[model samples]
Target: MKYFALLFALFFINFKQKTDKLIGRYSYLIEDNNSYIQKDKITFKDSVFVFDNKYMPKGKISYGNAILLENFINTSLVITIPKNQIEKDTIEFYMHDKNSSSANYLDEVTGKGRLIKIK
Candidate 1:
């Protein structure tokens, strides 16, 4: 039992290191914003996801976790990005609405969101 426990502990540590490992700073952009903005920064450090828009009123910080899934990354209540959509410096969020695929995040006015990493 001791040997089994030790082996299992080691395996868990290794797996945790590999999973939830996206660390960097990314910024979200809305439509017509076309280009990247330094404000509204979203940072991911060791699986911790944080969003801070300097322009927003104080005490309005948005935070979550960098949940790395096999095919998607869920960082928001109703949004998730396909693993492949995450590029060298860009992360694209697509909306999956109900009545179509039992999905969420879709609407008439908005369909997708983009995040550009901060160098």
Candidate 2:
């Protein structure tokens, strides 16, 4: 059917667009009063993303589901970390450019930081 074909095509295009942009590694540096704290890394693949921070408990790795939301020409990423061994936080990164390799990381309690795509 023509309608069925159109629906499938639209779905495929949406899926491809979402996956293509976020399949890489991003790094952010944590600092306090101009002193180096630690570096955090986030690697995204498909619908899941893995987070690594040396300051976390036992230097553990945490994972969560990543959702990319687009508004007009701007895109933002939300990573939902469930209640786990490390911590529970819903981090939202606002893209600074259309390419999305650079973003501003926002935390409700700690304010904001910069995220740069390393890979």
Best by TM-score: 1
Worst 10 residues of 1 by lDDT: 66-75
User: Superposing all C-alpha atoms, what RMSD in Å does each candidate have to the true structure?
Assistant: 8.5, 13.8
lDDT tens digits, residue span 1-113, model 2:
99999999999998776222344566754446855344577665644455675333222222334333223211333322222312212233322234434454423223234
TM-score of each: 0.45, 0.33
Candidate 1's clash total is: 1
Clash-forming residue pairs, model 1: 96-104
Per-residue lDDT over 4-118 for candidate 1, one digit per residue giving the tens place of the 0 to 100 score? 9999999999877633245677776644456534436766655345567544322222223422312123223244465555444777664443334434334422345677877
